[model samples]
Target: MATVSEVGELLIQKQQTITSAESLTAGLFASTLAEVSGISAALKGAFVTYSPEMKEALIGVPHILIQRHGVVSAQVAEAMARGAKYQTKADWAVSFTGVAGPDELEGQPAGTVFIAIIDDHDEVHIAQGHFAGNRQVVRQQSVQQALDELTNLLSKN
Candidate 1:
């Protein structure tokens, strides 16, 4: 099975909840987690903020961070994850932001995705993935990577 389902099973077993803040992948990351059976036991909520203003206003990403690192950078993804964790009161939170298209954003290449996760211990992790595909493929790969990372982190704990 895909890692999202595995992550769901682990989260259920551990009784941990997760929330999500999405940008480039939109809600694909959250939707993948929700696709797993019995995910409600651990799934908290999912927020789709595609715009920088929305990322800042909805997820509480700092304006200064966005100004410095741009919305597609790892810093914004980290802040978004942290903000989602606090906003949803979930044990863990994740954020996905980047350029997944035929065009570039803030000078970053397309298919560049930054996935960030905040564990229950308040530890944050970020990963940057470069994919070669259309918009759909990039989004799908990003979701898979995020789920895989979540599974790996859970294994360590």
Candidate 2:
């Protein structure tokens, strides 16, 4: 898997940009990107749509879509990435949505996460993961996986 720094380096080399929409991992995805030196040139912005409403209001996710697939599902993850892409006009956007908790959410078990990537072309790719750990560990894993996905996607381009 590619590290966040590796992703940042590639973005810089390509002269592209990125944005993030986060839920389960909060700002970890964006924060991690920020940790990479010289990333400011590539990271357009990021949003933390922790609330279901914000996913719609701030990120432009459709209410009916979330209602149908639940907030933690891949559908919502894709929508979140698309929204971030639309808002930031970045060359790439990543999104995270999941249940990272001591309790279930919308009947889904904890550690259930969906990660999505929307490339400049607006094509969407999604991945689902079920981690086993406490809330912090689940979130950490989500952030790492999200970055790795972005790295792989960038490598492809």
Summed backbone clashes in each candidate are 0, 0
Q: Write the per-residue lDDT of candidate 1 for residues 2-118, one digit (tens) a residue.
A: 578789998999999999999988898778788889998899899999998998888899999999999989999999998898898999999999999899999999999999999
> TM-scores of all models?
0.97, 0.97
Q: Which one is best on lDDT?
A: 2
Q: Quote the lDDT for 142 in model 1.
A: 91
Error of 1 at 73 (Å): 0.6
Cα deviation of 74, candidate 1, in Å: 0.8
Over 76-139, each residue of candidate 2 has an lDDT whose tens digit, in order, gives: 9999999999998899999999999889999999999999999877888898999999998999
At residue 149, what lDDT does model 1 achieve? 88
